[model samples]
Target: MTGLLRAEWTKFRTVRGWVLGMVLAALIIVLLGVFTAANNYSSCEGPDGDDCPAVPLGPDGSAVNDRFSFAHQVLDGDGEVTVRVASLTGTITYPPPDHDKIVPGVVPWAKAGIMIKESVRQGSAYAAMMVTGGHGTRLQHNFDGDAAGSPGASWLRLTRAGDTITGAESADGVRWTTVGTVRLAGLPPIVRVGLFAASPCDLTVTQGDLGGTIGKCRLARAVAAFDHVSLAGNPWTHDDVGAMRGAPALSQGAFRESGDTFTVSGSGDIGPYGLEGGQPVERTLSGAYTGLIVVIVVAVMFITAEYRRGMIRTTLLASPRRGRVLVAKALVLGAVTFVTALIAALVAVPLCRRILRGNGNYLLPVSTATELRVVLGTAALLAVAAVLALAVGALFRRSAAAVITAITVIVLPHVLATASVLPVELSQWLLRLTPAAGFAIQQSVPEYPQVTGHYVPQMGYYPLPPWGGFGVLCGYAALALGLAVVQLRRRDA
Candidate 1:
């Protein structure tokens, strides 16, 4: 078995064309990655013209939107704030009929309720019991946490006991139902308890004439009127967390108090930042598609060349065992492809990231573990794709037909799903059923059910989780190899 593996490796390296093909594959990946990053430049005209404000990072180190209106006062220790939400409404800028007129409406995720926070800082830890525009009532905490509460409730309350915060909702402000409880580690003795309101931009997606998706985000704001506010604290101080200075007057956040009634209005969101206004690290690997083509052509020719030259009979006569010979060839090819791809990915990711930063583009932060998975997964993807191509070549014994079949199954599905105008559901189905499911390994951002955004292939969201989709591709490779083994045993070498 070891001798067979060594012989196969010798054959691969002894061929100058094959060795140069692998080198060209790696070079394509690196060059295209750098080119993609160099072309991505972003600029925002702020006080320091062409200077963009830094995005806020949440506790988990991911970029987040933390702009909202708050009417808060200091709380000494364990305390509670209760407020009755009289109404929740908002205006959407430039909806359908007249592209220039602002219409009155609230997006589904617009929220207004009572909140308890460690500080007035944008990414500070906090818990809230809120009423959403369409999702009824919810208990949300620490940015990413959410629990659904009684729907259609107008009353909200938040109580703090030590570091534990409990949220409850009521219909009549009398009988309260505890919605959820969460603990904020390292909560200071003094904190901010307040009433708040926030709304995200209204996103509208339409199909383009050319079979692509067109998404437009319009400005939206939510206003909430809070009456019968019950809390013991000093005078209320207004704050707009993460607000940009010198913004439009209408877009600015504000609050008003008339006796016991407080009305707060604000724009922006308090959740995970989507793909807008930023780039994901995987965006730099856009060249993987082209590089895979080079790999496929080389892998197909690797096996077919032996058959075309009538050398398979001599090689098999030495090995005698056909199955072991095929296995040895697969192992040699898979290992070579994996090492080549790993080196390319290791060079492309960081080099492209620096280019992206230099061009004033904000990168959505990812954890170290997730970043490692993306890099390793990319190498594994190319390696397994090579194995699949080799198996297909063994089955067909023709270079052109085998290469075209492998790419049609693997790469074409991805392009159609992501770049074409197919319906989102149909595109998702293609990813699930085809070998292109392996591309899910490159997705860095996850879909948050709590946040409303376009979760489509074009937005880098996949139907399956990372490893699960990779497993689907592996299954195809294994099945193809099995068929090739059976064919090799029955056919004349």
Candidate 2:
């Protein structure tokens, strides 16, 4: 295997043209990363208040997402509650382009349903079966798991049987599917259990708005109309946790009753804060993915060129085990791309910080550790993409076709997702399923339920966690490599 690898390396390095292609990939990443970071500028000013709207930054200085809306009534003892959500619609009031009026836009992840909370303190353990604006039905619990379910389920039922609380969603009200169960330990008899709605979006600051020079991250609110709500065993009572109407943090949220049904409109934040102001969306390493195009093109050409120039026979002759030849080539391609991309990203990220701060643009808070992750993740993403393209090139053995396939399959999805070319649902799926998921590795800021802006693709926030998203791309590479090896073993080079 070592001999086979050495032979592949010798063939690759001896070619000056291919060497230059690798050089170009590195230069592209560095150049674009720097240029985009420098050019993308922003600024922010006020939101005058004591608990003034702040970018949720942790001890590490990266964004600490916190925001959501909760409308509920306190239940003093353990019991079960069941409700049918007729429909869930989410709303965000954006600062108008002219700053004269409030513009309303539908929010993604806008949720309406029944919840049982340990407290209204935001971060307390909770569970719910909900119907979202764009994500369909979900059985979300805790802080991170936004668990998915079959579409169009209308009934949300939560029952506290002893210490374990179980949530279920039913298509017909009679037949139910268990979303999950959670034991909110230290079992308090009383809990805040009722309807809730939340949305996170950016309140756009106009060109000369006084309240904000750039943005004041505003929380989103979801609304649900229920045909019926029954707390099977007890009487429900209103509990504000002591915040008066129009409180600074609560922001004018209220609940009302209309006949047997109830309507709740509340504003506050729950979960991670999606807050950043005056910070340019294009932070360091913006537009870095454009360089992956060149990396993939070069990587595809690496193998396709071998076949085109009739060098595959010579490659196989040196290593009679044809599968070994493919593995060696993939390792060589992935390693070279990783090094080149790493150097490029390291140089570009620092330059971006310098230029952005020089322009007086406030960047989203980032820790030193987060910075390292972003830089390394970019290189890893590029390395994986290069390997994917190389594998595809092996399968097809056609330079033009493989290059086209690589760009179309891997590159275009990222572009469409970033641009938010389609509906949010479709855009998210594109990133989740495609090789473009690799871009999540470079997501510097996280999506906070407390803040909403243009939650589209180009903002650099992703629906998947960094490594989780990158894993999708890696999966593609692994599958393609496996297939390419099989083909190499069976077919003539």
List all candidate RMSDs to the true structure.
1.9, 8.7
* TM-score of every prediction relative to native: 0.95, 0.61
lDDT per residue for candidate 1 within 194-264, as digits (tens), equals: 88999988889898787757888888999999998997447989998888877656566789988889999
lDDT of 2 at 330: 88
Q: Candidate 2: which stretches are off by over 4 Å?
A: 46-60, 63-272, 275-282, 449-458
lDDT per residue for candidate 2 within 393-464, as digits (tens), equals 999999888999999989898887666345556678888999988888877666654234545464556779
Global local distance difference test of model 2? 0.70
Candidate with best TM-score? 1
Best by lDDT: 1
